[model samples]
Target: MADLPDNASQRRARAFLPALEDREFLRRDELRGLRFAMEYHKADLLLREWGVRSTIVVFGSARIPAPEAVEEMLAAASPGAARAKAERRARLAVWYERARAFARLASVRGGALTQRPDRIRDNVIATGGGPGIMEAANRGAADVGAPSIGFNIGLPHEQEPNPWSTPSLTFSFHYFAMRKMHLAMRANALVVFPGGFGTLDELFEILTLQQTGKAPTMPVVLFGRDYWQRVVRFEALVEEGMIDEGDLSLFDLVDTPEEGWESIRRRGLHAHTPLAEAPDATPRAVDAES
Candidate 1:
């Protein structure tokens, strides 16, 4: 190699490496489309490989803590206003357990624990992969020893994915659109808890899809009736002709986790797993392919 001449001919003869191997080129601004494609395919391919054909998409507040964490905040507060705020959060904190319980119920009944003869899993819990409600949902799936997904996103502030989701199915995305797509792609039903701007964004995305007939009419449940009613005057949209009166039926309001799951069941979320079938039945009915 030392004997090689340092000349124009030698430089040209080197034969530059393929662009596919060029990490720097891939990171360039012009390759943004490729980056987006990569984000989508990574999650999509992995979800398929894991046999996840459908999911129960859960969306909720990241600020809200588990019940015990809120209790700790209550204990640490110095006085009046701080203590009052902590107490309020303590009330909302119950949602953490509710989300967890709901996820467990879905996973146990929704074929996530049992791969059918065709090897497809449905109603596998999928969350934003952050803490609070996301963590609670993922944790619930873990509780029942079922697989779950955590579609994490890159945020300006350092956000971490919860540990409860299956490692093979956990993913991180640089694009919110790609992350949202993954969340909505295979969603069999949606369960939303009390949350702020980000949660609202996701909720409306699916609502718009269903409203425009872009997505299937899946059951949607909005947990915490009081919070949702106080926060969103959905009736105003109907009265003002911004939306149809029936558009409000896109989601059901419920106060408890049991009520939330019941609404979905009533709305036609079929439990394809053996657990839901008749005990004395002979041959099981084949689960409909997704």
Candidate 2:
């Protein structure tokens, strides 16, 4: 057996370390609750420091490419399925440009270009912190010198945060639930583009929240009207009685960037302190589910 002196030294070394400094101890399953809270507060504290009062979230497929990149991609293709897919994406590339345009328009019109007297910035762009539409939105914000956020989540394949997002505002999370919370909590509006499983997941999550009254109402605009209708039979959901016809009113489909922005404005989207407009203390955070 090891001497008592050696055992005492081991205990002393570990005991001297601070709780936060003990990375191995922190990773234990028993410390998961603390980790969850840490994840929540890390982003929360940083966002508060930046005075980001609200955001316009942009969600879409990370596979989509900007129009200029399409020609290069097609040229590099091996032909057959790859070339066919490239051609398909070439058509979808229009949505990428439109996403960029809408983001710039929103950032400028929605007051992200300036901070108010309270030092809070509203209607700032926020994205999943990955490529495709996320990159485009962040790029748009950059075009006008406005800051945008990217809440990136660690994945099996390790998705990188897009370069277009403001460096200081970009964050990474290990837990998808924590990432989703941050995405929803501070969002003032959501502009969804044509996407696949991931995009659908984000879109429906927000819609469910709004449907159940778990979240405050905000503008929900889906770009690529023809694509979304083809992809989702929202009318079927109503017809089948899985959802009410009135629930269809929850979001609008638009084609152009101008139409998307106009739809948002027409749906009561505003640029200033939305939550702070009310004097109530409890409204800011009603509960964790929000």
Candidate 3:
């Protein structure tokens, strides 16, 4: 093993002795302690390296359960071993459908959700580092050879840093609040995709921020027109008079990548660099209490 740094606690048994710097033989336990501290501090450094600007946070379902085995067998195979064959076919079809759904979600008119300089230049893509839609967006950016970032979390399920991410940019967080912080910090725009509870959580957080003027200049774009319209009834809020008609204008519903790009660009709202560190990179999650 390489020799520990002179300041390493193990090497500097005097680390705890009032003096902060030391240059001596490192103790095993002290070395471990120093290493842990270094590892913990690396989170921010990694995030900074990832270039956290111009991000579009995309979320979507991972489990699009395949069709029933019997249905597949009936569609393809006949009697005897037909059931097994049919089931396999059905599963394959569902997988194909799931892949297609992700492909459409990843496709932004310009190209696949691979990394690209345009995302960095346009301030357009970022996400909660994982598979599904997040992977698609990062992949799309990578497709064009641009560094993409992912705020990956240590989750029991539904989380992993996608392969497309710029190596140093992948961040794993112990705190959900911290992970969410990185998501909204330098975000020039928020591009929401169809997802379950996590998607709803992120959507509301952004809405709350814009509605409260906390992230006033930031604009939100919702992808998947049909899904969004059916999922939430913003019109009801407007009609109820709880919010003004103008309030609904904070976010624009978009069906295509071109339209989504145009809306933000037309207004000049997403001009800021998405990765530049913000003065207020730390904000309480956007909710009534926050």
In model 1, the Cα lDDT at residue 85 comes to 80
Kindly list the per-residue Cα lDDT of model 3 for residues 187-229, writing each as its tens digit: 6667776667888998888888888888746767777678789
Give the TM-scores of the predictions, in the order they appear: 0.88, 0.89, 0.61
lDDT tens digits by residue: candidate 2, 1-290: 77554566766797678998999899999999999999999999998988888999999999989888998999998879988988998888888898888887787778776657777888889999999999988887777667889999999999998888888899999999999999999888999999999999999999999999999999999998889999999999988999999999999999988899889888989855343342221112122111
Query: How much lDDT does candidate 1 score?
Result: 0.85
Residues 110-224 of candidate 1: C-alpha lDDT, one tens digit per residue:
7787757777888899999999999999888887777889999999996898878788888999989999999998999999999999999999999999999999889999999
Which 10 consecutive residues of model 1 have the lowest summed lDDT?
281-290
- Measured with C-alpha atoms, the lDDT of residue 145 in candidate 1 is 74
The list of candidate 1 runs beyond 4 A from truth reads 1-3, 6-21, 274-290
- Assess candidate 3 and give its TM-score to the true structure: 0.61
**Model 3's lDDT to the true fold?**
0.58
lDDT of 1 at 66: 88
Q: Name the candidate that leads on TM-score.
A: 2
Q: When superposed on Cα atoms, how far off is each prediction in RMSD?
A: 5.7, 7.8, 12.2
